[model samples]
Target: MERRDIEIFLTLAEELHFGRTAERLGVSGARVSQTIKRLERRFGVALFRRNSRHVALTPVGAALRDDVKAGYERIQQGIDRAMAAGRGFSGELRIGFSSPLVGEIIMAAAEKFRTRHPDCAVRIREIHLSDAFSALRAGELDLQITELPVREPDLSYGAPLLRDQRMLAVPSRHPIARRASVTVEDLTQSPVLVPADAPGYLLDTLVPAQAPSGRPIARVPTLTSRQELLTLVSAGQGVAVVGSQAVRFHARADITYVPIEDLPPIEYGPVWPGGAQSSRMRSFITLVRGLRQNEDDVTRSHDHEPSD
Candidate 1:
């Protein structure tokens, strides 16, 4: 039998109804009957028992279906692999990500993507807050899935994949550490940690220069990396406004991650160079979108438990 006939047979075998199968296969019920009759005559046996209200596969037909279904799946998988290879899905896809939690999230999605497009290999590169845009603009990264508020004219970002509540990272010795929850106004008493050389908007996002009340929130001299920024917070030098993810990945003995009761949550998603999107990039984006739909609750067990 032809491949199309095999497909129709498999579909019909699962559906087990002439009219329903015909509707699914986009053919007439008469045509389905004709195919079954021809196949039975060729094999000289009744493959199905049918009446007005029922359609059931006979013993021989059931055996044939069980054997063919596995083989059919293998055949389809082979064809899909070949098609994926030809569609540029069989190449290296370099991805850049920031923050350890986001990295874990993206890598989890990448694993699923590799299972779907086995030929495509994904290599994740860690991005620093100071170098998020520079790496993308330099062609060093095909895509960077990071925190948003992307203002670059040449960069495009996908929809927010996940949102995390804003948390205030403070030294265990800081005064606010005694509070149940902190607000943007409290940071005015201490210098907020900032990443050195990051864009002004990003700096503002991380540790705003002023609170909603327009009181200036002073900053410690910019730190070179996220690790350095957190280290300073741990050392009682300053507070750092960060995301809930910090509790999972950047937990430190000297720091407390208190939820900022009044600030907006941080949103993250994929960002790539404008008009430079590739088939591999598109496939990765699709996989991330799927992962976003079924996010698993992550364990937020940190040593320094601050009230949410």
Candidate 2:
């Protein structure tokens, strides 16, 4: 099958909606239907079972998807690498960040990157939790520093850029706010507000399905933005587990940020599509690593110094 054909099939299989598949691929619904029909006829079998309201893959289609997805991804990666190599690192490098702290770091890196490679433009944007991987997959972003545990098969990640303590955001008047620290078990006292329509693994990291004691924690999928999440917490709608940086980035009079007594620190890192890295991307990665190392060294030096 052609690359576009494979893309359409895989996208339709994943989306299970003709209109959505068409929208994602920048084609019309009729085109998507015709392509699927052509593929079915060429294969001499029904690849999909569709009706007025639903679309589903047949057993043969499922097997084909499982078999070809990895190979197709590799082919795409090779094409990307070849194209990037042919271009020789003179175009815009798009970077994305998921949080304010990451954004600050990316901004600093972009400045240094531009200074070093004046010919290459650096475009930075903020990525949200709800639609984390789509932008990267759609080629809208080259790299993003997002929370870890990115288990996507086609993406690659690097070492942690920032590690921050996990904290619970609660209303100032709430009983949990009086505590010095809290734990996953404490989440049971109130519904935990989480980012809506996020991946399960990410949501699990922020707020687990069950605490250590096997008690179920109630989750309220109401968060859409940082401000909205904080507003909800301040209004006593629900509590949320957030990174320590929120204390500085999202300070509010009505909310108190309490550190989680037992949860591991949240780690943010660079995630990029394809296994191969372009020259511009590799240079930016190196710069970011060097800056982070310098910061760590300074922090350690300060910690061991004698006071006057």
Best by the lDDT measure: 2
lDDT of 2: 0.85
Name the TM-score of candidate 1: 0.67
Clash pairs (backbone) in predicted model 2: none
Backbone clashes in model 2: 0
Cα RMSD for candidate 1?
Answer: 14.2
| Model 1 Cα lDDT, one tens digit per residue, 62-147 | 88787887787688767755767777577778899887777887788789878887777889999887677888899888999888
* Cα TM-score per model: 0.67, 0.70
Model 1 poorest 10 in a row by lDDT: 294-303
Alpha carbon lDDT of residue 197, candidate 2? 87
Provide the overall lDDT of each model, using Cα atoms, as 2-decimal numbers: 0.78, 0.85
How well is each residue in 241-274 modelled by candidate 2, as lDDT tens digits?
9999998999888999999988998988789997
Model 2 ranges off by over 4 Å? 1-88
